[model samples]
Target: MILTELFREQLAYFKDINYAKEIEFLKGFEASEEEIKEFLEKISLQKD
Candidate 1:
Protein backbone atom coordinates (compact mmCIF):
# COMPACT_ATOMS: atom_id res chain seq x y z
CA MET A 1 0.00 0.00 0.00
CA ILE A 2 2.80 2.36 0.87
CA LEU A 3 4.60 1.60 -2.40
CA THR A 4 1.36 2.12 -4.30
CA GLU A 5 0.91 5.50 -2.69
CA LEU A 6 4.49 6.47 -3.52
CA PHE A 7 4.03 5.41 -7.11
CA ARG A 8 0.83 7.41 -7.44
CA GLU A 9 2.58 10.47 -6.02
CA GLN A 10 5.42 10.12 -8.51
CA LEU A 11 2.98 9.57 -11.36
CA ALA A 12 1.12 12.75 -10.44
CA TYR A 13 4.40 14.69 -10.30
CA PHE A 14 5.42 13.51 -13.76
CA LYS A 15 1.94 14.30 -15.11
CA ASP A 16 2.33 17.88 -13.81
CA ILE A 17 5.71 18.14 -15.50
CA ASN A 18 4.32 16.86 -18.80
CA TYR A 19 1.31 19.17 -18.54
CA ALA A 20 3.61 22.15 -17.96
CA LYS A 21 5.69 21.18 -20.95
CA GLU A 22 2.58 20.88 -23.10
CA ILE A 23 1.41 24.31 -21.97
CA GLU A 24 4.82 25.78 -22.71
CA PHE A 25 4.84 24.28 -26.18
CA LEU A 26 1.35 25.58 -26.81
CA LYS A 27 2.39 29.02 -25.60
CA GLY A 28 5.14 28.97 -28.20
CA PHE A 29 2.41 28.58 -30.78
CA GLU A 30 0.19 31.13 -29.03
CA ALA A 31 -2.58 28.56 -28.79
CA SER A 32 -6.01 29.55 -27.50
CA GLU A 33 -7.98 27.37 -25.05
CA GLU A 34 -10.06 25.84 -27.82
CA GLU A 35 -7.00 25.03 -29.84
CA ILE A 36 -5.30 23.46 -26.88
CA LYS A 37 -8.38 21.39 -26.14
CA GLU A 38 -8.51 20.22 -29.72
CA PHE A 39 -4.84 19.35 -29.67
CA LEU A 40 -5.23 17.37 -26.48
CA GLU A 41 -8.29 15.62 -27.84
CA LYS A 42 -6.39 14.59 -30.91
CA ILE A 43 -3.60 13.27 -28.80
CA SER A 44 -5.97 11.30 -26.62
CA LEU A 45 -7.63 9.82 -29.65
CA GLN A 46 -4.28 8.85 -31.12
CA LYS A 47 -3.28 7.22 -27.86
CA ASP A 48 -6.30 4.98 -27.97
Candidate 2:
Protein backbone atom coordinates (compact mmCIF):
# COMPACT_ATOMS: atom_id res chain seq x y z
CA MET A 1 0.00 0.00 0.00
CA ILE A 2 0.97 3.63 -0.37
CA LEU A 3 2.51 5.43 2.59
CA THR A 4 -0.58 7.49 3.30
CA GLU A 5 -2.79 4.38 3.33
CA LEU A 6 -0.35 2.54 5.52
CA PHE A 7 -0.25 5.41 8.00
CA ARG A 8 -4.01 5.59 8.23
CA GLU A 9 -4.21 1.84 8.81
CA GLN A 10 -1.68 2.00 11.60
CA LEU A 11 -3.35 5.03 13.10
CA ALA A 12 -6.71 3.30 13.11
CA TYR A 13 -5.30 0.20 14.77
CA PHE A 14 -3.34 2.10 17.40
CA LYS A 15 -6.24 4.36 18.19
CA ASP A 16 -8.61 1.43 18.48
CA ILE A 17 -6.33 -0.26 20.98
CA ASN A 18 -5.65 3.00 22.84
CA TYR A 19 -1.95 2.36 22.53
CA ALA A 20 0.34 4.84 24.30
CA LYS A 21 2.65 5.08 21.33
CA GLU A 22 -0.25 6.34 19.30
CA ILE A 23 -0.44 9.46 21.47
CA GLU A 24 3.28 10.13 21.15
CA PHE A 25 3.26 9.58 17.41
CA LEU A 26 0.29 11.85 16.90
CA LYS A 27 1.96 14.52 19.02
CA GLY A 28 4.91 14.32 16.67
CA PHE A 29 2.51 15.24 13.89
CA GLU A 30 1.21 18.10 16.05
CA ALA A 31 -2.25 16.72 15.59
CA SER A 32 -5.00 18.21 17.72
CA GLU A 33 -7.55 16.03 19.53
CA GLU A 34 -10.27 17.20 17.15
CA GLU A 35 -8.20 16.24 14.15
CA ILE A 36 -7.52 12.80 15.56
CA LYS A 37 -11.15 12.23 16.30
CA GLU A 38 -12.10 13.37 12.82
CA PHE A 39 -9.60 11.02 11.22
CA LEU A 40 -10.82 8.08 13.27
CA GLU A 41 -14.38 8.83 12.29
CA LYS A 42 -13.52 8.91 8.64
CA ILE A 43 -11.70 5.60 8.77
CA SER A 44 -14.48 3.98 10.74
CA LEU A 45 -17.01 5.07 8.15
CA GLN A 46 -14.93 3.50 5.43
CA LYS A 47 -14.75 0.25 7.38
CA ASP A 48 -18.51 0.06 7.61
Candidate 3:
Protein backbone atom coordinates (compact mmCIF):
# COMPACT_ATOMS: atom_id res chain seq x y z
CA MET A 1 0.00 0.00 0.00
CA ILE A 2 1.07 3.62 -0.46
CA LEU A 3 2.46 5.61 2.46
CA THR A 4 -0.56 7.88 2.88
CA GLU A 5 -3.05 5.02 2.72
CA LEU A 6 -1.02 2.98 5.18
CA PHE A 7 -0.72 5.92 7.51
CA ARG A 8 -4.48 6.49 7.45
CA GLU A 9 -5.19 2.83 8.16
CA GLN A 10 -2.75 2.87 11.05
CA LEU A 11 -4.41 5.94 12.45
CA ALA A 12 -7.76 4.20 12.24
CA TYR A 13 -6.40 1.14 14.01
CA PHE A 14 -5.01 3.27 16.81
CA LYS A 15 -8.27 5.14 17.13
CA ASP A 16 -10.19 1.89 17.34
CA ILE A 17 -7.95 0.75 20.20
CA ASN A 18 -7.95 4.17 21.87
CA TYR A 19 -4.17 4.37 21.65
CA ALA A 20 -2.76 7.60 23.07
CA LYS A 21 0.69 7.37 21.52
CA GLU A 22 1.29 6.86 17.79
CA ILE A 23 4.98 5.91 17.66
CA GLU A 24 4.19 2.20 17.82
CA PHE A 25 1.75 2.40 14.92
CA LEU A 26 4.24 4.41 12.88
CA LYS A 27 6.83 1.69 13.45
CA GLY A 28 4.65 -0.80 11.60
CA PHE A 29 5.20 1.03 8.33
CA GLU A 30 7.95 -0.10 5.96
CA ALA A 31 9.86 3.13 6.38
CA SER A 32 13.05 4.27 8.01
CA GLU A 33 12.86 5.54 11.57
CA GLU A 34 13.64 9.08 10.41
CA GLU A 35 11.00 8.90 7.72
CA ILE A 36 8.41 7.65 10.18
CA LYS A 37 9.26 10.44 12.61
CA GLU A 38 9.00 13.03 9.87
CA PHE A 39 5.66 11.69 8.75
CA LEU A 40 4.37 11.60 12.31
CA GLU A 41 5.53 15.17 12.84
CA LYS A 42 3.67 16.26 9.73
CA ILE A 43 0.50 14.47 10.82
CA SER A 44 0.74 16.00 14.28
CA LEU A 45 1.10 19.44 12.83
CA GLN A 46 -1.92 18.95 10.59
CA LYS A 47 -3.98 17.94 13.60
CA ASP A 48 -3.10 21.11 15.45
Model 2 lDDT per residue over 1-48, tens place: 466666666665444554455455554568777787778867744631
lDDT of each: 0.49, 0.62, 0.52
Candidates' TM-scores?
0.38, 0.40, 0.35
Stretches off by above 4 angstroms in model 1 are 1-28
RMSD of each: 8.8, 6.6, 9.7
Give the local distance difference test score of model 3: 0.52
- Indicate the TM-score of model 2: 0.40
Candidates 1 and 3 compared: the better one by lDDT is 3
- Candidate 3, which segments miss by more than 4 Å at Cα? 1-29
Off by over 4 Å in 2: 1-28
Which rank order by lDDT, best down to worst? 2, 3, 1
Kindly report which residue pairs in candidate 1 clash with one another.
Answer: none
lDDT of 2: 0.62
In the range 2-44, model 1's lDDT, one tens digit per residue, is 6655554443232343443445455456877667556655554
